[model samples]
Target: MIWVAIAISVCLGAAGQIFMKIAMRDAGPFPGLIGVVDIARYFWGAILSWPMLAAIVSYGISYVVWLGVLSRADLTLARPMVSLGYIMVILYGFYAGERMGWERVLGIVLIMIGLFLVVRSGARV
Candidate 1:
């Protein structure tokens, strides 16, 4: 159960990152140090936008769940489970319009296999 929660937290965290990337796509990079009010005013629209808001919410939930997972599971067990998010994030990136070449796809597949091997190793330990 603790491992499950940790995995879920990782998924939420990955999703949050993806949402933030989508939100920033049109908004451009972080602005150079300008007037305080100017920077604040410019980001006010983005901070309140749906994608940004979703990222915030996802992060909040992930933090809470991670705390719960840590209380029940050893860090070693919980942390490795989070590697699943690499696979999740790669898929999300592809779905969100990032063009994935064959090399990237093969790399992601290798990562998934590595994650599975790690899980099998944990069973032995």
Candidate 2:
């Protein structure tokens, strides 16, 4: 129940990040402090992208589920659980052909260790 909701929230958050990345694949470099038209064009393109739409929906659902999770679990415990999204997003990004440097790998490892410690401490409560 509560665990399921937490899992769903993490997954949805990761999915949203992946979808956004995919949607931005073709969107060339940012126009750097450009005109309003450029900004509008960028946002319009994003709004029309199916992947972006999916990302928005995924994030919306994740937020709702996260609220439910918080209602049942302590914030100190549940917040660290959201770090699971970092691991999932990194894996998905690597699989999707994004750069995977050793630094990123090390960061992921650190996040995993932190998450483990948090969960373990929470369980003792």
Candidate 3:
């Protein structure tokens, strides 16, 4: 059950990141950091975007599930598990037409290796 919550949290976190990326895909370049009005306008646009709303909801669900996970597991174990989100986000980004350079592929490999080590270490105890 705790593992299920952990998995849900990781998936939700990744989904939230993907949705936020989608929401910002067409937002153009940032209008500099000089004006409050420009910032407000940007935020208002984000608030009205369905992808942003979905990201918010996904984060909320992830947070709730994370709370449940914390109650059942050590923070050390659970925190590393969240790194699984990086793998999911990378895959989703690839599916979304983003370029996947060698660096990113290496990063994904390292993350997978780290996750394996962490999980393996946990199993030893």
| Candidate 2 residue pairs in clash (backbone atoms < 3 Å) | none
Kindly list the per-residue Cα lDDT of model 3 for residues 15-125, writing each as its tens digit.
Answer: 999999888875656778979999889878977799999999999999999998888798878899899999999998888889999999999999989988888885521
Task: Highest TM-score: give the candidate number.
Answer: 2
**What TM value does model 3 have?**
0.89
Q: Pairs clashing in candidate 1?
A: none
**Where does candidate 3 clash, by residue pair?**
none
Give the clash count for each candidate.
0, 0, 0
Candidate 1 at residue 102, lDDT? 97
For model 2 the local lDDT of residue 11 reads 97
Q: lDDT tens digits, residues 30-87, model 2?
A: 6777899999899789768999999999999999999898888888888888899999
Q: Give lDDT tens digits, candidate 1, residues 62-119.
A: 9999999888777766677777777888888888788899998898888778777777
Candidate 1: lDDT over CA atoms? 0.81
Q: Which stretches of candidate 2 lie over 4 Å from their true place?
A: 122-125
